[model samples]
Structure formats: structure tokens, C-alpha cells
Target: MKATVSWQQALTFSGKTESGFSQTLDGNGETLSPMETVLLAVGACSSIDVVDILKKRRLTIHDCQCELEADRAEEPPRVFTKIHAHYIVSGDNLKEKDVDRAVSLSAEKYCSVMLMLKGNVVITTSYTIVD
Candidate 1:
């Protein structure tokens, strides 16, 4: 839960977690900006939930991918105003209801990252199941 951010260079920083993981981020366009990283995290977090839920259902999953689209306010701070997550799940004998439930559970209950932004940001989700 603990982390630190150290300045590396002009608009660049190194972020390290207490668990010994680290990441480099830059405010400039040279790399993934802090905001961009957050956007990515949202998709990753939700995707994890979807994968876990589907696995628990014993569906023979082949792959799962989450595609995210976001909108930001034009004003200063430029925080995310809206986000949409599209999940592409491939498996045998996958039911539409199961996929829908997994996506819904992730967005509505799981996925702490999405839940944290639930009120301030408009979060939406969709999914496609493929064989």
C-alpha cells in the first residue's frame, strides 16, 4: 500500500511500491504520463476481476482482453470525465449471461480502481464472448 515517487529528470519520475515494484512515468509526452497510467490501471484492474470471475465459473477460457476509452475535461486538472471498458473474452461454452455478469460484477462490485472513480467519473462496461 505504501509507495514513493522520486523525481528523475524534467517531468519524469520513478514510482516504487513497498512491494519492491517500480515504474517510470513522465509528465511530458516522452512516456506514459501519470494520467495515462491511471487510465491503464483502470482497465487492468477490471480485467483482472473479469478473468477471475469467469475462471471461478469453470469456463474454459482462451483469452481475455480489455479495451478502454476515456474522456477528460478540458479544464485544468483534466481529470477523467467518462470511461468505457470493452471486454473481449474467448472461451468454449461461454454463456452470454455469464460474461455479462462477470463484467457487471467487476464494474459494480469488484475493481477497486473503478469503484474509487465511480462517483466522480462516468464508468460504463460492455463485453463480447467469442469462441
Candidate 2:
């Protein structure tokens, strides 16, 4: 879990992970802001867990999308106050109980990013399965 960031120019940066993945981050609104990247990480982390869990259950999954919403404190170091991840999962024979279990397992046990923020940030999750 190692990464680095290089200054590209005024308030912009090019970030890369040791694994060879890279993304552009900017404070001048040229790309995703640092805070926005955090939210994206939370969503991406949980969604991957959900999809993997569902697949391991032998469910036929077609698509998975995580929509995130957040609130930030209106003060210096304005950190996240609350966050929500709404998962839209499409598949065949996807039951509510299964989806619920997957979401719960990710929030409570699997998603590292979400779990790390549990104490400092209020996190909530919901899911919708379309067949």
C-alpha cells in the first residue's frame, strides 16, 4: 500500500501508486480534489467488496454502481462529517437478504476504507437490486 504524488503545477498533482496506477488530482478544480478522491475511494472500496461477495455467493451479477454523498464540517481542516454509499446492483435472482448481507459485511467487516473512517465519520449504506 505505497503511493507518491508529484507537483504538476499550480494546485495540481500527478499521483501514482507503487502498483503502477495513476490519477490526476487538483486543488484548482482541474480534476478530482483530494477530498473528492477520499469519497471515491470509500465508494470504490465498498463496491468491490460487494461485487466480490455477491459473486462468491454464486449470484449472477451484471452491474454494480456505488453512489456516494457526504457532508463536511464548515471549519478549518473541514473533514468529512458524514457519508453515505448507495449501491445499485443489477443481476438475476438477486435477493434482498443476500444484498443486505453483502452490504452489511462490507460496511462492518470487509471495506477497509469505510471501516477506517467509522469512528471519525458517520457512515451509512443502502442497496437496490434490479433484476
Candidate 3:
């Protein structure tokens, strides 16, 4: 439940998670932002459930990616007012029904980030299944 972020350079940083894994975070030349980390948190939170739900349902999952969009408030400290998560799943024999159900389960109950942010942020999701 801890992490460390070290400055890598201007507008960029390297973050080490409690598990010792690392990732590079950058702002594409703008000032360093925490929004990227928030998005990553949301993605990671939902992805865990997505995979687990698919596995429990015996779905053959080849790959998955989630894209998120956030609208921030205009104030001294920007906060997300809304978030949209798009899940694109690729697999063999993937069922649209399962995908829909998995997403619903995650957003409605499974994802910790979704639950924690639910009251403050409006979260929505869409899915694309490729077979």
C-alpha cells in the first residue's frame, strides 16, 4: 500500500510500487501531473476483476486493454468529476454477454477504485470484444 516517485527529469518521473515494480510516468512536455497515476489506478483496479471474472466463467482471454478519460474540475486543485473506462478485450470464443456482465460486476461491485471514487466521480464503461 505504498509507493515512491522519483524525479527522472523535467515533467517525468519513475515510480516504484511496494512490490518493487517500476514504471515511467511522463507528461508529454507539460508539467508533471498526477492524473495519469489516477487513470492507471482505475485501470489496474478494474482489470484485476475483469480477468478474474472471465477466468471464473471459463472465457478464453488473449488480451485486454482499458482506456480511461477524466474530466477535471477547474480550481486550485483539479479533481476528477467524471471518468469513462473503455475496455477492449481480445480472445477466442469471447461472448458479448460475458463481457457485459463482467464489466457490470466490476463497476458495480468488484473494483475498489470504482467503489471509492463512485460518490465523487461518475464512472461509465464501454466494451469491444474481438474474436
Candidate 4:
């Protein structure tokens, strides 16, 4: 519930929770940025539900990866304009209907981050089923 960010260097930091788990955050232009990390939080938050919903339906999951893209506003203070998450799911005998339903349920009903991003950012998704 509580956390802190300690400075590491220019555009880099380490954020740690009260429980002590920590992650290195950096504007390295390759992996982590502040805005990119926000999108990651949103993606990871929803991905949990997506996988859980699919698993409860008895779907076999080989792999699941979410690719998040965002359009940021051009202004003195930038903000997100739109966001999209493409879920690439690899599995044997996966059903498109199930994947669609799971995604829909997460965005519309289950995922809180998705709800928060509504209006400010247009959120959308597409799925690829890999056999």
C-alpha cells in the first residue's frame, strides 16, 4: 500500500514497497520510463484478470503477452491520449470467443485501471491466437 522511490542517478531510481520488494526504474529509453511504467502497471493489472478468466474456462495457455501502446498529448504537461493493448496468446486449442469474452470482461467489468483510463485515454485491444 505504501512505497518510496530512491534516486539512483539521472532519470533513474529504485522504487521499493514497505514490504521490501524493489524494482529499478529508469528513463533508459530502452526499458523503463515513468509513463511507460504507468502503462505497464495498467497492463499487468488487467493481464492478471485475463489469464484468470481464461483459466477458469479451462483454456490451455501456452503463453500470454500484452503489448501496450500509448499516444501522449503534446503540451507543457503531457498526458496520455490513447492506449491500446494487444494480447498475443499462444496455446493449443484456444477459442477466439473465450479470449474475446475474457478481454471484454476485464476491460468492462474487472480491471480497475481500465476503468480509470476511460475517457482520458481511448483503450482498445486485439488478440492473436498462436497455435
Best by TM-score: 1
- Model 2 earns a TM-score of 0.97
Clashes of 4: 0
- Please identify model 1 stretches exceeding 4 Å from their true place: none
lDDT of 2 by residue, 1-131 (tens): 89999999999999999999999999989899999999999999999999999999999999999999999999979999999999999999999999999999999999999999999999999988888
What lDDT score is found at residue 14 in candidate 1? 95
- Candidate 4, residues 1-131, lDDT tens digits: the string is 89999988878888999999988888776447778878998789888888999999888898889999999999946889888999888877988999999888988899898898788888998888888
Candidate 3 local lDDT, 1-131, one digit each (tens) = 99999988877888899999987778774543577778788998998899889999987899889989899999957889999999999888998989999999999999998899888999999999987
- Candidate 1 matches the true fold with a TM-score of 0.98
Which residues of candidate 4, in runs, are more than 4 Å off?
27-31
Error of 4 at 16 (Å): 0.6
**Candidate 3, superposed: residue stretches over 4 Å from native:** 4-15, 22-32
Model 1 gets an lDDT of 0.93
lDDT of 4 at 49: 86
Residues 1-131, candidate 1, lDDT per residue (tens digit)?
79999999999999999999999999888888998888999999999999899999988889999999999999988999999999999999999999999999999999999999989999999988889
Predictions: Cα RMSD each:
0.7, 0.8, 2.7, 1.9
How many clashes in each structure?
A: 0, 0, 0, 0
